[model samples]
Target chain A: MSGASTSTAVIDPYAPFSQGKTIQLSSASPFLPRYLASTLPPHTSPSHVYNTRLRGKLLILDNPLRESRSAQLKQERAAKREAEKQRRVQGVMGRREAKRLGVWELRKEDAKWALFLPIHHLWLGYIAELLQLPPPPSDDILHSTDPSKHRLPSVPGTQAKLVKADLHGSILSVKRAKNADLVGRGGIVVHETENTFKVVTAKDELKVLPKRNSVFTLRVPVYAVRPGTGEEDGGPMWEFELYGNQVCFRSSERASRKFKFKETIEL
Target chain B: MFIDLNVPFPEPIVYESQFTPSKKKQKQKPAGLTNAHASTSAMAVVPAHPLERLRVPDRKALRERVEMLIHLGYTIIAFTQSVQSKLDPAAPVNWFDGGEGTVFRDLDPRFNGGKRGVVQLRRLNVVLDEASEKGFGFNAQTTQLLAGYDILSLTPLTTSTFQSACLQHSLPSSSTIHLITAPLLPSPRLPYYMKHTLVRTALKNGARFEICYAGVFGDGARNWWANAREVVRAAAGGRRDGHEGVIFSGGAGRVEHLRAPGDVMNLGTTLGLPHETCHAAISRIPKSLIIRAETRRTYRAILSEPKLVFSAVPAGAAEDGGEQREDGKGVKGLMEILNEEEERSRKRVLEADDAGEGQEGDGEESEPSGRKRRKRRRKNR
Candidate 1:
């Protein structure tokens, strides 16, 4: 009687059974066993079995469960609030980093560089500072001395030397040029490159003069230190008249170049 | 010395327009306008004055005109030749040999006698109506003009044209720019063109505003008068602000149109220019312009303040060497005086220290206070 009851309970009522054929079919149908295993609760305790069965019914869509619209909106709002909180944390971190790095002070220095240097030179000077190299000459060097005392050297030998000297902060006057309009104009040298000088004239106007086909007389001041006292003594300034085409390179580049000391060539 | 900075020379060739109608339109027979027609015809029939006649004078006539100008005491006369454009090849070719050489040649023989007056050949480029289509190109035209002319005067028709001509040039600082004020007579007020900022820039760039007096003697006298008054007001305003760049000229096209320097000065005074400024316009300014033109012609000349430094003279030459030595001495004397003054001050300070010490020692010493102290100090020294 017990055997008969066990067989009846183990067998599916809806499935067809035919002795040997049914056994073969049951062995071949592995998916049915896998599905039955998935549906069965692992635990036999009353509370666990009840919960597992409820989850199985929900997974199978036997119960048509839906979330409320207000609850969905509240979830979306919470996600946005979390994202905003993360952004605020990031902003606070950024401000703290900027403050620690003295970014505002750096910006103030950049502003001063923008006022004085050309765009390319500004970057060069900035990079130079980063590399801990010597900074390029500044306007303060020019303003420290009396400009009126600065005169150009008239001697030919001295003139050649003066032409090779760094022209930054020198007072320049156009002596002669093919352009008649440029004759006899004077200006202060603000910047210089390989082929041009950026000058600020007496009228407070900036002018760029090409170093080709123009003659310039540079008035450079000479400052000396007293040998004994080591005090600065204002020396007599010298004047130099130069053919612009001959000295059309940066002072540093020209210094590295080798030239015949006494080559008798007409400029 | 009086100078007429602008007198149009190589008299203008009048070409009658081929497009004029073959016959005048018959007076419209206005049905009831007979009275108005009669008055209009009467106005047109009035006899033309001798000065009003516009005739192209020959070279002889120009010489006679110069003689008349000399008689009227114009010590310096800048004969202005109008240059049209480079596309007009004739104008540039005419400038090369015909303009400067011919005028000077024509006037030289007549003025060879005791008169030490000068005749300057100047160029006037009237850039009217065409500046809008093509910007004032610093091309072959400008280069040729700058190369050929002694003094270049640009008469831009509009304010923008003026700015482009004056401010946009590469070398505005050294350029001798003259602003012609005659054309403004039939148009707007002078201040419309001569804005304060523009005037300041012009002054800074060494540009001089010129007033041509011959415009006043033209057929449009009323318009000219109004223009002249406005120009004077603008110039006077500039002067009051301590920037004086006004120059007077008689841009006479013919002998009859010419006015005396005295008359121009009186006109300047009447137009509200200060007396000294009126004199400077004719004398000092023109002289400086002549020097500038002379320097422009000679490429080798080096202009030093108050004098020109010539490179042609040998460094060791004794002819003008004394002047340089004298200048050196003068500078050295000034320096010596300064040094002496400094030494004297130092000596005074040392004497003050000695006096202070002597006064302190007097209380402790047993010698006569003042008289013996000097002898004692001398002995101690």
Candidate 2:
């Protein structure tokens, strides 16, 4: 008992403070046996501390007898997702800006922006379906003529529907702007306000660009993106410009806005 | 695409006399003389500005002709108004602005009936006779006047007019003259010879020659055969495709003049156009002309429409190569976080397997947190 080295960490169970209580081999803290290290504020995880002093004795980190914290976190996330889905079905989208989503504000992305590519694809399909453009240009010409001349753009009757199409998730670049900083900024539209767009650029930047005095180069694939399959049906890319000043309306208000071909007098 | 680009719209009755005829009658045998003859005989009579205001009888006749075309299975029909009087270039060009609606007001533009609907098209045929050779009002300022027309056809009555119509007015860059029809009704032969160079130049510039089958049944039946054969021979020699750029339309005035498309194609064969080429003239050739003519309103006669779309690659990677150099602190990227999450999940999965023996007996109640619950129960028991 007396030959123990002076430098040795000989924690005594019978010491006055440790008597009738569990040994304090690990540093005392409010949140550890819970191992909720990730739950703490970022950069505040107790990494410098011996991650767990009782890691060997208590076997909490690796033992089969106790539950894994990671599995517990997965359960919590799954539950949250289910609740979100229920809220969506009930028409309780957490915000009025988006028509069909709950607690689903898609403003910025520090990560997971690539995940939005699929959403962008769905937007392309939505437009193609709304426009009802002809079957994407084929390498083979249409040998079988319908012998009908009134297939003017296939159906001129659908012009009204095309004028009021919804433009969510469209990829656009600022072509002209009053402010030079706003020019050349292009992105997938994450959210649209009455007079602005919350865009997540390819650099994963969320820019809230003003709509007035700007011309946006909207890029669209000629063909529709097939749903559920992440591949395109192969068509050339086409670009057209939309005057931002003309489109300064909330997404809901845009459907009711009347568009005309009258020449603009302003430069 | 069975198209009849020229179903002659009825001449509007201008009650005001064009040239009083000096009120001096010869008292000769002919009791029925049309107003046009009196004006032409007066010598000093200036050509009337082709009347546009329609009376009831005139509208009724036009409606009847359009219905006849629809009944005869002509899918697309142009109510062609032949403007014989030269237009004053300085005057307002919207003369035929709402002519189609005025003529077919009660009828729907897409008035569907037997087989399919008759799509109404308004055509403006400017007759370039010797009297108006200086300018038939074809110029930059006349686009407003031509905007109302779905097709612009030219009728060259003189050799000078024919040369201008073929070489100058047929250019795809600036001109809108889609069809060139020589006035074969009164003329013995085309005022100008159908030279191969002129024919090829016009054809190259996307001008189509129209062979009016209605002329064959008119007073000029004899003249129609001679003029049409020359046109077909010259236009066919211009292009490799024997009957390449010739379309058959009816410059029919009376109801009886309108013939079925099959009969018209048969009439084309009479002009020595092959049976296949004749079928194409009424079907394929005219259909293409209609599409070309529709381009007059576009930005620059562009065929494929342009629209906006997303690029295949990410815009940052496409435009700039410095995506990774976006300035910031030691920011955790997406891949790093994702990999860490995956590692933790794998660890949890392994732990579940190790604890599988303890929970296997009554594994049916297995919640992910069941292991902790079971351990607590053992301690209590």
Report per-candidate DockQ. 0.01, 0.06
The CAPRI classification for model 1 reads as incorrect
Q: Per-residue alpha-carbon lDDT of model 2 for B240-284, expressed as tens digits?
A: 554586889988888888988889988887787767778878876
True contacts kept of 1: 0.00
Against the true structure, whose DockQ is highest? 2
Task: Put down candidate 1 lDDT per residue, A1-267, tens digits, no spaces.
Answer: 655455444545577655574333453453344445544443334445444563335245476668899999999999988987898888744567777987533242233322332432332233223323322233354234444433322333333344345555445666545564555554546667788877655454566777776766643323232224322123333333455655677868865754332111112
Fnat of each prediction, in sequence: 0.00, 0.14
- Give residue A88's lDDT in candidate 1 (0 to 100): 84
Estimated TM-score for each candidate: 0.41, 0.45
Docking tier of model 2: it is: incorrect
Which candidate gets the maximum TM-score versus the true structure? Answer: 2
- lDDT, candidate 2, A79-166, per-residue tens: 9999999997996656564545433455444424576667777787787787765554443322222223112243223334534566
State each candidate's clash count: 6, 8
After superposition, which runs of candidate 2 have C-alpha atoms over 4 Å from their true positions?
A1-267, B13-52, B90-95, B99-116, B237-239, B303-381
